[model samples]
Target: MRVAMIGQKGLPAAYGGVERHVEELSTRLAKRGIEVTVYNRRWFSDYQKKTFQGIRVVTTPTLHTKHFDTITHTLTSTIHALITHHDIIHFHGVGPSLLSWIPRIFSPHTVVITTFHCIDRKHKKWGGFARIMLRLGEWSTCRFAHKIIAVSKTIAAYALAVYDCTAIYIPNGINPVKPITNSEQIIQNQFGLTHNNYVAVVTRLIPHKGIHHLITAFTGLNTKKKLVIVGGGHFTDLYVKRLHELTHGDKRIIFTGFQSGAALHALYEHAALVVQPSELEGLSISLLEAMNYGRPLLASDIDENREALSDYGWYFKSGNSADLARQLKKLLATPRITLERRAKIGQVYVNNLFNWDTITSDTLHLYEKLVAVKPGKKRRAVAAAFRLAK
Candidate 1:
């Protein structure tokens, strides 16, 4: 089957959960002998290559602004996919799924799949107008697409409650990493970080991510452990500056901008505790990776985080700096051996649950099931699929 992926920024994922999700799924599907084509936005991609890991990468043009970039790219990508006659066109984000109607209207024969990766309208980065459009995008994704995949259980329940759409619950998967050891010098020399002495949180610097709250919480703690925030902005410059202001020129706070590869793994390896303080998430790749590395975790108690963590690690009240400070103090005071023991148990648990191969098989099962149906029977097929999934 020839499949096309839209909405993610590009391949060779440096950051972003959607990018990593697309890359993992596409590569696995390609290996299984399915022809996969991933459309990359020109503004976000620096990759000059035509392909990666057996999957085709097509760089499509976009408007390059924060508001217009995703929607514009999806429109052009849908058009190109229609012309090229792909068997399935899969749209990733709610923002880009705004254009799913183009494919549904123009070419009724093609199978259109949309993944509700997150509720993008709730993010603080977008303005009022953008949020309105994003809300519309959510509506578009739910009603226009033949199949909808929600990344978290809460998201699926949300679809049923709000849109009355029975979105199939498919959580994000994590690949096991060989945790980098004996890299104390590599981390210390680059970022003044020492092994098992610094608190780490890997997240994009944005308003909704709650980095400011983390900074406030970290400062209140009496521990000598440093705070390391790893990631860059998603068109939120002023918010990033505000994060710096919240630090108040504290030398203990380290901002490592957009790390990947061995360096990132090293950070995860050496962290005493990994925190995911985001106010909201569909399903966090960062949260899963921390578990993948078997780092003792401390996450905000958002329903999404609770859904993923589930007695796996420590939790604090979401967006409450005082409670976060208290949780950190308590966890920091605990013995290292105890923390490692719990983290290791959590690691084993997550490995058995969220395997990438299993996720790929489940996804392919749905794809083949839908693609087998007759073209004119889309409405009946879609209803049946939804019923079966629910």
Candidate 2:
């Protein structure tokens, strides 16, 4: 089936979980013989439309501002979608949801599905006006879309509680990567990370990500384990500077910026344990990758993380540095388990739950149901599908 996958940022997945999700899912779907067109905002003056992994990458015009960029891109992409006859239009994020109104208004025959990754207003980056616009978009889209995909049961519960919509739960999936090149020594030398002597925290440097708490916790830990922070922020100077000041010039906590490819793989391989200290998450892809690599996880106690990891890793109180430090110390004090056992369990969890094949099959099943129904009558179609599932 022909599908249009819309994301705020274009594919090739520069950053963010949704972008990565689109990239991996689209590639896998294409291999399964589904035609996928991904719409991405052209960030650079020289950005050109290209194809990657048999998926068509369409670069559309967008306002580069934080508030208007998504809206502008959605409007333009809506125009594109309306003109292009596709079996379904799958939108990621609330930005595209603003234009969900358009498809119903114009081309009611096209199946429009959306996955609300996070509650927009609750995000720390948004301002008052931006938050209002986002909530408005969410209301408009969720009220009209054919189906809603929530990444976690927590998010699904939030959707029902807040939006009063019953969304299907389809958690994020990750492409597994086995350790390839041995670049640990090179990365260590470049970033000054000691071999096997540091804990790694990989996430965007956002307030809600709880990096500040992680740093504070790391500083108080009794053991000699250092903290290696990986990732960049939209407000890089503000957060990077704040994180540095919080650490107080102690070189124990190192910000290695954004590392990907072999370097990132190497870091994960040599990490004592991978920590995700986000205050909130909709099933973190990073945590999944860490688990796939078989590194024990030390994450904030949140519903989604708990749901994802369960007993596979250790959890600490969210945003509580003292509690986090205590947990880290306790884990450090405990003796290490056999690597083979840890790796085996991790692989099983990923293969059973987070594999792309399973996720894509479920996605296509939803798409088929959406496509079978006539346009402007989505609620009935959704009702029928739920009934059929039961």
Candidate 3:
């Protein structure tokens, strides 16, 4: 089967969850003898090659602005997919799913699938207009897409409650990180961090990620250990600037702008604790990576984070800096032996639950089922009617 994946930045997957999802899922699908084409934004993917890891990478131009980048590229991609011969057109994220109706209208025969990554409208990054559009996108996804995959049970429940749509619950999966023996000095020399000497946060420096809250909480506490923030902003320049200002006087607070591969693996491996104080998430890849690396976790008490980690890690009140500070202090004071024990248990839990092979198999099964079941005449008629109405 030929599948066109739209709405992610690009492959190689340096940062974003959507990019990682596309990269992993598409490569696995290609290995299964399925033809997969990923639509990429020009800015995110610097690769001049058309193919990577057996999957076709098609780059499209977009207005590289924060608001326009995703939508413009998705618009162009959807138009391109309409003309191409593909069995399925899979869209990721709600922002791009807003245009799912375009494919439904133009190519009624092709199966359209969308994955609900999160309640993006709730994110602090979007303005009022963008949030409203995201809501409409959610609505479009529910009404137009042939099938929907929710990355978490919380997201699935939300879709069922809000849109009256039942979506398949397929949690994001993680690959196990082999322990690095040679990279210990890389962390020490570059970031002045030693094993178990600092707390690390691996996420974008956005308001919704609650990095500011973490900074506030970390600074209020009395500790010699450093706080390492390990991600860069996509379009959140003002928030990034504010983060720098918040850490201006504090030399203990380190900002390592977007480290991946061995360097990122080392950060997770050596850290005393990995904290994800995100106010919103749809099964964080970073959290899973930390767990895979056997790092003890402390996250916000949101449903998504709770569902992801269960009883394996610590939790603080969401958006409460004081509560986070208290939690941080409590975790720091805990015995190192206890922390390591919990980290081992968390690693086993992730290995059992979030296996990438399982995720790949399930996704492929869904695609096959959708392809085998032909669209009903009534459904096609309805789609044609909607096109005429438009």
For every candidate structure, what is the RMSD over all alpha carbons to the true structure, in angstroms?
A: 3.3, 4.2, 1.7
| Model 2 residue pairs with clashes | none
* Candidate 2 lDDT (Cα, 0 to 1): 0.80
Residue 101 in model 3: lDDT? 79
For residue 109, give model 3's deviation from the true position in Å. Answer: 1.2
Which candidate has the highest lDDT of all? Answer: 3
How much lDDT does candidate 1 score?
0.89
Summing lDDT over every window of 10 consecutive residues in candidate 3, give the lowest-scoring window. 381-390
Q: For every model shown, what is its TM-score relative to the native structure? A: 0.95, 0.91, 0.97
Q: Please give the CA lDDT of all the candidate structures.
A: 0.89, 0.80, 0.90
lDDT of 2 by residue, 64-148 (tens): 8767788888888878877988878888887678777666656667888999787767777778988888887777656867799
Residue 7 in model 2: shift from native, Å? 2.4
lDDT (C-alpha) at residue 94 in model 3: 93
Off by over 4 Å in 1: 179-182, 377-390
